[model samples]
Target: MARFSYRGRNAQGQEVSGDMEAGSADLVASQLGSQQIIPLSITETETLGARSFKFDQLFAPRKVELDELIIFSRQMYSLTKAGVPIIRAMRGLQGSARSPLLADILGKVGDELESGMSLAGALQQHPKVFGAMFINMIHVGENTGRLDKAFLQLSDYLNMERETRKRIKQATRYPMLVMIAMAVALGVVNFLVIPSFSAVFAKLGADLPWPTLVLIATSNFFVNYWWAILVVLTMGAVTVWQYVQTDEGALKWDRIRLRLPLIGPIFERIALGRFARTFAMMVSAGVPMIQVLGIVSRTVGNRHIGAGIEQMRNGVERGESLLRTAANTQMFSPLVLQMLAVGEETGAIDDLFEEVADFYDQEVDYDLRRLADAIEPILIVALGVMVLILALGVFLPVWELGSVVRS
Candidate 1:
């Protein structure tokens, strides 16, 4: 949809102007009319020039952080529960918001609210900050008059996500630090230490072993063509980054991420857990089955897994039972499948989905606890091999020289 700037007079004869996304100027006018505003003009907002980079944005935070979203949800829940008017609550939040971006967004949302847009509709304007699932839940809540409950659910879900992310980062930090140290060591040896040893060995004029020859050759290449190597590495990184930004590449990369060694299972469990939690929440909130599937599919985080959920939605639309459709996806473990079956039979799918989420969370926790232990041995072996190679390459030459001098 294109964004249009509109000017109008509201019910109290107050003049207002704001930007809104819609298909056409007529649609924008129609929306304003619904809000009891007589539209003076609606014009499509001009797009920014492609080459016009905003330097200030480099240091400014444009995107809302997860922590900010969680706080917003929590505060909104409290305010709504206290029966505060939605517009006043939004204005209060906007004034008190720590993030300038979030405050600006809330201000726009408040304006939209004053213009008679639903809460969900106003929030939908910022897709980057509020995801499809979030907007849908609010939409459902508005329809069902349970907006407070929706915010409560969102806060819970965001907290769970935040906890999972923290655990993953904690578990992987050691391995990441070790790998970085190894890389730095490798660079230092090649660029500084090995060159000195190579010069000494060249002066000795003794027959060098293959290990020393390999080390000298590697060091020489690093010393000679470092710029070329750096350029190649930079280009490769840039290429990969660009590729992953594309739809096909992102899908492929996400699939590959699920199969990565040592951490693949962790990624899978996290994605599946997110899906289960969202599914359970939507179902318990009385969202339609079809709509729940659609929302959960997009919000699952892994594109490959999301495609599977999309297929399940299609199968259900084709008149297949939820159990049958889910089984056909082949994404769930037998235990989860069994739970789903029982839930389907007992008409308690939401409760069963909750159980599934808990099961995955437990599995994720257990795997995370073991993740450090599992990766440590591999890192140790790698460090050992590097040390052994350097030892053999350097010491063997010294041993030969000593023998010759003694003889």
Candidate 2:
């Protein structure tokens, strides 16, 4: 018998780890399952030792991408819709998941299921992997006997979210590339070209223009202290990343994100679209309006929008109309408000929310389609201005030197 190391959560959702004598890692996982432990990982002792020898492996985090979740959801939907037992479907998924992180999660969920935990309960053990909205929908589906439908809905939402995010990233790509190129060009001029020019001016023994003097000093600092500059920039970025993970800092930044130039409206539309779609889907699935609103509030990417949703939830709790609560927040445009009012009057609120989501989707698509057109002109103008500044700053002194030599 070979010894294998296993890490898992017990029935109480607490982590448990140990080594067991087994024929294989799979056998170890089975033993853990029989012991009511949800196996997270089961590896041969030799493999464990080898992993420990790699120092970088000890510190590296497991990353689960959105695309992986999208694929997993679709797979789950197909399996469940085909009438396969949830356990069998989970086991199949665990074996076939492309992402190691996702495979590990599915394996643990399977272990929990083997130990008689409800699917939602098993998923709840890893809140970060399955968000509150996801778990809630699953719970609703399990209770409603529509697990297949829930996964199908989740797949659609995730696909839409992914596409929307892809569009935003694509829209920003050109500008990001332009900025990086500009930085590289500036660095080249400062490090290579500027020093050569300064050396020539020094040999000429002529007093330089103020712009040339400024450029020379800037180049010298960069040449001497590039490491310090790099360190400062890295520290600043790390600090911002850490701060943005905090609730208050995240809220502040999310609010600022909505107010940013050029992309602010796009962000607003995306947030509203997410809110509307989630609300519509959950409400249509027989989830209580209050719970639906609460879930939607927490999942919206923008904290400002989330806060508005929470406020609307609270207002609804106080016996106010959904339309009134939504309108009072001043979050929705007049057209959306009108639609909500009509939906309320007609008792077709879910359908109206769906329409609202669709409207925002189209609006966002239209804006994104023209984003390059809007940004390209600005980029070109900015690039021209930068070239003009560099020309005036660098060439004026060279012209002065030429006039002196001629005289």
Q: Which candidate should be chosen as best, given lDDT against the real structure? A: 1
Clashing pairs in 1: none
How good is model 1 by TM-score? 0.92
Write candidate 2's Cα lDDT for 70-179 as tens digits. Answer: 88888889989899999999999999988767887888888767765678867876667899789988999999999999999998999999999899889889989998
TM-score of each candidate?
A: 0.92, 0.85
For model 1, what is the alpha-carbon lDDT of residue 360?
100
Global Cα lDDT for candidate 2: 0.87
- Tens digits of per-residue lDDT, candidate 1, 280-351, equal 999999999999999999999999999999999999999999888888988999999999999999999999
- CA lDDT scores, all candidates in order: 0.92, 0.87
